[model samples]
Target: MNTALDPTGATAAYLAKLPKGAVETAAHYTQGSHWVLVIGKLAAVVACLIILRSGILPRIAAMTGSRNRQNFAVFATGFAALLLQALLLMPWTFYADLVRERSYGLSNLTTGAWLTQSFITAVAGALVGGLLFIPLYVIIRRAKQRWWMWSSALLALLIALATVFAPYAAGLFNRYEPLQPGVVHDVVTDLARQASLSGEEIVIYDGSKQTDRYTASVTGVGGTARIALSDTVMRDPVDIPAIRAVVAHEIGHYKHHHLLILAGAVALLSCIGLIMAAFAFPTALRLLGGGGVGGISDASGIPVLLAISAVFTLVTTPVVNTVMRLVERDADAYGLNLAREPDGAARALLATTSYRAPSPSRLEEVIFYDHPSIESRLRVAMEWKAAAQGR
Candidate 1:
C-alpha cells in the first residue's frame, strides 16, 4: 500500500488556487439558508397555534367520541401540522439542498431524486415524531407536574436506541458495498488493524450518488460497529495517502468511542432542556393565548412545547458545538499520530474547503463549525510535521 506524501508541494499549490469566491458564495448561501429555516420554523409554529386556537383541533377531536379515538386525533393533528410545516419549508429546502449544491458543483442528484429523498425524509420524521408524541402526551396526561422528568427519561432512552440502531437507519438512505480489493482497500484495512478493527468492519458506500462531498463515519456499536467510506473519497482529486489519513481519523473516532460519548452528552442536554421547558412551557402557552398546565396534553400545547424546545436548542448551540469541536480535535490528533502523514492530513483538510470555508472567523468557528476549520487543522498538521522533522 502506498502511503507516500506529496513530495513536490503540488497539492498545496493546487489547494491554494482553489477559488476563494466559491467558498464565500457557498458560505453566504449556507448562512442565509440557516436563518430562513429558523424563521420558517417559527412561522410554522405560529400557524399551528393559530389553527389550533381557531377551533380546528377541537373540532377534529370532537369528531372522535371515545378517549382512545381522541388520543389518535391528537396524534393525527400534530402529524398533519408537522407535514404542513414541511411543505411550507420546501422552497428553502430546494434552494439550500438542491440549487445551492448544484451551483457549487457538489451534487449529483437530479431534481426528481432530490424530491423523492425529501419526501422520504419528511415522512420518516413525521413517523418518528408521532411515535414519540403519543407516549409524550400520555406522560403529560398522567404525570402532570413531573411529566418533563419522565419525558426526558424517555427521550434519553429513545436517543440511545437510535444510536445503537443507526446503521440500519442509515441503510435506508444510501447503498453500501464492500470496498474492492486494491491499494486503497489495503491502506484502509491496515489502518483498521492498527485501530484494532477487523476487515468485516469496513465498507464503501455510494455517497457520490447524491453529493460530491467526501465523508466517512463509524456507525453503530458492538457487533454493529462499522466504518463506511464515501465513494467520492476513492475517486480522483483525493489521493491515496489522504484517503488513508481520512480513514485513520474515522478509526480514531471509533477507537476513542466518541459516538457513545456524544450520545451521553446529548442525553444529558436533553434532560436539561426538558427541565427548562417544564418551567417555561406554562408561561409560553399563556403568551400564545392557550391554557396553562391544565392543557399541557392538548393538541394546541404541542406547538408551545416545540417552540420552547427550539429556544432551548438555540441557546445551547455554542455549548454543544464546543464539545463537538473538542472531540474532533482529539480525533485529528489521534489520526495524525497513527497515520504519521501530516501532508496527507493537510490535503484531506483541503478537500473539504470546496464546501467549508478554509479559514472561518473565530466567532464563526465557535458558533457554527463542529469541526476545526481547514486553516486550523492544516496548521496543526504543519506543527506536527515540524516537531517530527526536528526529532
Candidate 2:
C-alpha cells in the first residue's frame, strides 16, 4: 500500500474514512464475541470461571447427601462450567474481535475471509487449549495425591506446548512466510535473531482490513515470526519516517527479547494456574461426591474451581498488562534508535492513533491500552532524535 500521500487525489479521501470519534468511542464501552478468539482470547480465562461460579450445580450438591463433599462437587461443577464457558464465548469472541473489525471499517475482510480466519483461530485455540483441559481434568482426578507438583510439571509442559502451538497452527493455515528482504528487512532480522534471523520472511497481514489506522507489530516467537500492517496504513498519507520508526519499534520487540520475555511471563502464568488447579482442583474431591479412584461418588466439585480461577483472573490480568507496558517501553526506545528519524515518526503517530489521547492517564494506559499510546512512542522518538542531532 502507498502510505505516501496519494497523488491520485480521491484515493486518499475514500481510504481516509476512519473516523477518530467512532474509534475512540468504540474503544470505550469495548467488546468481542469469539471469547478466546482472534488471538485476543478470553474463553479459557473468563467464561470457564463464570460457569463454575454460576452456582447451578453447587445448589444441587448443597442439597444432596454430602454436605462436606468438596472434591467431587467442585471438580464436576468446574469442568462443566469451563466447557460451557468455551462453548458460549468462543463464537462470540470470534465475532466481536475479528468480525467486528471487518464490519466497522477496522478490517478489510470479505465475509468469507473473515469466517475463514475466525474459524481457523477458533479451531487452533480449542485444539491446543480446550482439548487439553479434558485430559488435564481427568489427570487431576487420577493423581489426587500429588496434584500440585504433577500439575505444575504439567503446566510447564502445556506452556511449552502453547508457545509452539501458535507457530505450528500459523503454518497449518498457510500463514507462514519467509521474511523477504525489504528496506527494513535487515533491521528486523537483526532484531529477531541475533545470529540467524536470516531467511525469515517478515509475515505481515493486511491490518487495514477494518479501520483506517496505521499499526504494525512483530507477533509470536521463534519460527512464528509475523508482522502485520493495517490497510489503513498504505492508503494513508503517512510520512516514511513514522513508518520506519514504527517498524523499527516492532523490530525492537524482537531485538530486545520481548518475545522471549513475553513467552516466559506467559509460561509462568500458565504454570501457576496449572499447578494451582492441580492442587486446588483435587481438594474438591473431598467436597461433593467421588468414587475415590473408581466409581461415581457425588460429582459436584467443579464450581469451587471456577470461583477460585475467576478471582485469580481479575488480579492477574492487570499484572500481565503491566509487564506488557514495561516491555513496550523498551521496544519504543529501540525503534527510536533504528529509525534515525523522529519528525516523520511523530507525524505518522498522530495520523494513525488520533483516537488515542496522545497523553492518556497512567491508569488508562495500564488497564485499557496494550501498545503504548502514539504520543508516548512519538515522545520517546522525538526525544531520542533530538539528542542524537544535538538539537
Candidate 3:
C-alpha cells in the first residue's frame, strides 16, 4: 500500500470505503425508516381525533366528576393513541435497526436474540416511563390551573428521577452483562475508561445486533449514568485513534450535561404547554377530526396539549439539532485534545457516513439528525487538525 498523503490528508488517515445503498437495501424488505416515523406519528395523531370525535370522549367526560373531567378525557384519549403508536411502530423499528442492518452487512444478531433485545428495550422504556411519567402526568392534571409552574416542577422531578434511574434502566434492558474492559483492548480506551467508572457504568448493547453502525450512548436518570458501545463500533470503527475521536464526543455529552439540560428544557416547555393545553386541547380535538370547535369540552386543555405536542415535535427538532452540533463541535475538540489525531476522527466520520446520509439536505438534518452531519463533523475535525499543527 502506497500510504501517500494527499493535500486533503494534512493529517494521517486510514480507512476502508462503505458498501452501497445500505438504507435502500434495507427498504427492499420492509417499510423505510423515514416512512415508519412519519406514518407512525401521523397515525397516532389521527387516531387521537377519531377516539375523541366518536362519542368516546363525551362519554368519558360525562362519567368523570372532576372539574377538569373534560381535560382528562381528552388527555387519556391522546395518550392512548400515543401508547398504541409506540407499540405499533416497534416492528418498523426492528426492521430498520436489526433486520436491515444484517441485510446491509452490519448486524450479527440471530432472530431470537433480536426479539429478546426488542422486548428488553420496550419493557425498560415502559417501566422507566411509568415510574417517572405517571406521577408527572398526574401532577400536570392537578396543576392544570397553574399549568406552567407545576408542570415544569413535575417535569424537572421526572428528569432527575430518570437520571438517577439510568443504571437500573440499562441493567433491565441490556440482555448481556457488561463486557470486560480489556475485551476491547484493540481500541476504545475512552469507552473502557467510562466503563470502569465506580458509581456509573457502561453497558455495550451491541448496536450491531440489528444495524452495522458503531454507536455508543450514556443514558438514564439520577445516579444512573451508563454507557454502551455496539459490537459494530467495536468491530468496524475499531481503530484506536478514530475510536478515541468518537469517545471524545460521547464524553462531551456527559461533560456538558446534555441529559440534565435537555430534561430542564423539557420541564420548562411542558409546564408552559400544560397551561396552554388547558385552552388549546379543545381546538386540537376538534381540528383532529375536522369537526367544529364546540364538539370538544375543556376546549382549553385539549387544544393546548395537541398544540404542545405539535410544537414540541416541530421546535425540538431544530433546537436539539443545534445542541447536538454544539456538543459535536466540543467532542471533536475533545478527540483532538485527547488523541491528537483529527484525521483519524475525520476518516471515522467518512467511513460510517456510507450507511447514514453523509451529506444530507439541511432540512433533512434539521428534521432528523441525532448527530452532526458527516460534512459538518469533518469540517470541524479539519479545523482542529489545522489548529493543532499551527497552520
Q: Tell me, what's the RMSD of every candidate?
A: 4.0, 8.9, 5.8
Q: Candidate 2 on 1-391: residue-level lDDT in tens? A: 4233322232223224446675564444232221222233334444544544455655644654574544444444444445465566657655665565555555555667666766665555544443455455555667765555566666676666565444444444334344456544555455456423444456554444444567666655544546554444445353556666677777778666776677688778766875565555545433422323122222444434544465455457767777888898887677666666566566666664433544567776676566676556755665565467554
Per-candidate TM equals 0.88, 0.64, 0.70
Best of the candidates, TM-score: 1
lDDT of each: 0.75, 0.55, 0.56
**Candidate 1: residue 353 Cα off by (Å):** 1.0
Winner on TM-score between 1 and 2 is 1
What lDDT would candidate 3 get against the real structure? 0.56
Which clashing pairs does model 1 show? none
Steric collisions counted per model: 0, 49, 27
| Candidate 3 residue runs with Cα over 4 Å from true position | 1-36, 53-83, 87-144, 163-168, 176-178, 181-205, 218-227, 236-238, 289-311
- Tell me, by lDDT, which candidate is best: 1
Q: Hey, what RMSD does candidate 2 come out at? A: 8.9
What's model 2's overall lDDT?
0.55
Q: How do the candidates rank by lDDT, highest first?
A: 1, 3, 2
Off by over 4 Å in 2: 1-84, 90-95, 98-104, 110-116, 134-145, 164-197, 210-213, 219-232, 236-238, 274-311, 351-357
